[model samples]
Target: MFREVPVLPVVVPVAAAVFLILLWYLHSRDRLSAPRAAVALALCVYAAGVVANTVFPIFLDKPARSALWKVYLVPFANYEVGDAVTNILVFVPIGVLVPLLVAKAPWWRVVAVAAAFSLVIELTQLVTRNLLGGGHVADVNDLIFNTAGGALGFGLCSALSRVPAAAALIDRFRWR
Candidate 1:
């Protein structure tokens, strides 16, 4: 799965975001010196890159509609383990980063953020298909898998927040 996943989409944005965060911390008068904020911002930007790569036709260099709306709500229909897993994994960072960035937000807020972001991506694909003439299928399966990935990320972060050492580390990342 790791080998099959493209690294550039995640890496490029993350690197740029981190560099920007470091610069912001160094130059800005604001006290946003939390390492966690930097990480969260980088992750969110990386997640956006992943979504933009997956949904938009910007990479294709042509205006041609190659996608149909995939309305299937069922799982495992024409599913490859790699693609299904990748689809979920792509959004996992969003799941982890959003909750980390927002202080004291309830767990459900993670789900809401994940769902809203996923829906926006899907809707973008749907709209661009008609307007730009080239985009991904706005599939329900992608939304479900992406939301599941986000929930999983939230669970992992929540569990880590319970650990003494991890909590201490998380605190170091906190904006305040």
Candidate 2:
């Protein structure tokens, strides 16, 4: 039951953000476009939702981790397939969106941002579990996987942007 957290809770907000961004692109003419703002807004909201869902309970009175804490440094040492994949999948959009929204930014900067984001999540898990006593265990593997996910996302989006058709489509939105 614990592992069955609904994916919709996370995906719905992001999907909505994407839709709004498309709309904003269609109607706006300011230098600051919708896609860029949407990416920032979506990233913040998504990060918050992730931390809240993973560590804190939805209801005010619900129980949390509470005295149970663990950490895994060894990659795949105690792997749970679903959790690992889900972690990577969740961050992939950030990877893709960051580069797309900040097209002029260097690749290293995009990667650094992604890594920093993952690092924050891991640290949050550690701090909340130890100090507040309710959060998932912090794991280095998550950092690795999440970083890789971000990189992959950047790669995929970047490649797509190079394609003539994709480039034309993306250019219409004026993401840069």
TM-score of each: 0.71, 0.68
Model 1 TM-score is: 0.71
What value of lDDT does candidate 2 attain over all alpha carbons?
Answer: 0.68
In model 2, the number of clashes is 0
lDDT of model 2 at position 123: 79
- Every model's Cα RMSD, please? 6.0, 5.6
Q: What are the per-residue Cα lDDT tens digits for candidate 1 across 1-176?
A: 01223446655766677767655764474646658556756765676576558654533234545565434556667766786698788878766687656778677898888888888887877775554554466777788888888888888888898999998887776553
**Model 2, position 119: C-alpha lDDT score:** 86
lDDT of 2 by residue, 1-176 (tens): 23333446755676667666655664575545555565556655676566656655323333455654567778888878787788788778767777666657566776787789888877777765665554477788788878777877878877888999997866654466
Off by over 4 Å in 1: 1-30, 59-76
The whole-model lDDT of each prediction reads 0.69, 0.68
TM-score of 2: 0.68
After aligning candidate 1 to the native by TM-score, how far in Å is the CA of 70 from where it should be?
5.8
Candidate 1 pairs with clashing backbones: none
